[model samples]
Target: MRRGENLRSEDYMLIDPFINGVAEFHDRHRDMRLDVDNMSYEELLALEERMGNVSTGLSEETIMKSMQQRKYFSIAEESPSSLEPCCICREEYVTGDDIGTLDCGHDFHTNCIKQWLTQKNLCPICKMTGLGT
Candidate 1:
């Protein structure tokens, strides 16, 4: 994604309601595995791996802690020669604006980046994950 790139509907990870219900049922019955009968071991493993990705997303607490680890400061306190407008909001940054920077070295308005991270766990600029790590 670019500074002003438009994302398609498919670009956003829309949670599937049926998947959520299945995941919840699985959580309630931890010992039960998906009934993938008569399949090869490798096919079963592949399905299990893909299900893991679909079922798990970063928790809110995890997201908050990761945001805390990011660098945040006022533009006046840590003055820079130049700054880009926040890609999420597309407004030029001014002094006294609260900015947050990621480990990927991209900066945006603190609120803007926080909102972005709440839905996705990667840098809006570089598409890098593991911000908490």
Candidate 2:
């Protein structure tokens, strides 16, 4: 998925309610895996109801604030010798690339870090809460 892209409703429907992993839902009547796209509107509604509410964690506003507070620095702004590649995307930082410094002192591409923060509030490297609770 690209940075800042919202997951589709179908993606949410496939998420496992008990675990974060995705699970193939079986169509008991048909004795086969549930095909979300092929299901009728009523069937979709019933499946959604069964899944119940799913939480993606931190609110948009909170994530935005956390993102805003992140220290942004480009390779041009800092010495290239001090720059490091973003671990999440496994891409090297370019001269003009903007990087966000997390509270844990780990740095990543701003977009990469923002994407990660949406699902988790912790710094990926240290697993420290970056949202300040």
Candidate 3:
């Protein structure tokens, strides 16, 4: 069957409620993930993948150890200067301003940045990976 063209009434009746429940559950527990101190390395990684959030409860020691084990690592840019202002807007940085940094080392004002990412997965500056910024 073609994608999304085989749904039956019963499917909606069953799936909609489950989807709503899961959404509600996520909204309620969104900030309540298990702390890194309480989580094994495996558990922490699994939670990270499941929620796609940066865990804050981990200690620097544990974080270093986990990295030594190849458990987790950051893709954050080396420094803010490693990147340039967004190409989409062709603007320069202003002091004490709001900005968003992407995984690819690009920065932009949050409002303009999101619209660009929504349209494509490329850096507004270099058109590299478009996961964030």
lDDT of each: 0.66, 0.72, 0.54
By lDDT, the best candidate is 2
* Consecutive 10-residue window with the lowest summed lDDT within model 3: 65-74
| Cα lDDT of model 2 by residue, 68-124, tens digit | 444444644576667566889988776567677677778788888878887878888
TM-score of each: 0.44, 0.47, 0.32
Off by over 4 Å in 3: 1-85
Expressed as tens digits, the lDDT of each residue in 59-112 for candidate 3 is 333322322111122235545565556466766555555566566655566546
Cα RMSD for predicted model 1: 22.0
Name the weakest run of 10 consecutive residues (lDDT summed) in model 2: 67-76
lDDT head-to-head 1 vs 2, winner? 2
For model 1, how does the per-residue alpha-carbon lDDT over 80-130 read when each residue is reduced to its tens digit?
A: 546567889988776567777676777787777777776777887788872
Error of 1 at 118 (Å): 1.2
Model 2 C-alpha lDDT versus the unseen true structure: 0.72
Per-model root-mean-square deviation over C-alphas: 22.0, 20.4, 18.8
Q: Could you tell which candidate, 1 or 3, scores higher by lDDT? A: 1
Runs in model 1 lying further than 4 Å from the true structure: 1-60, 68-82
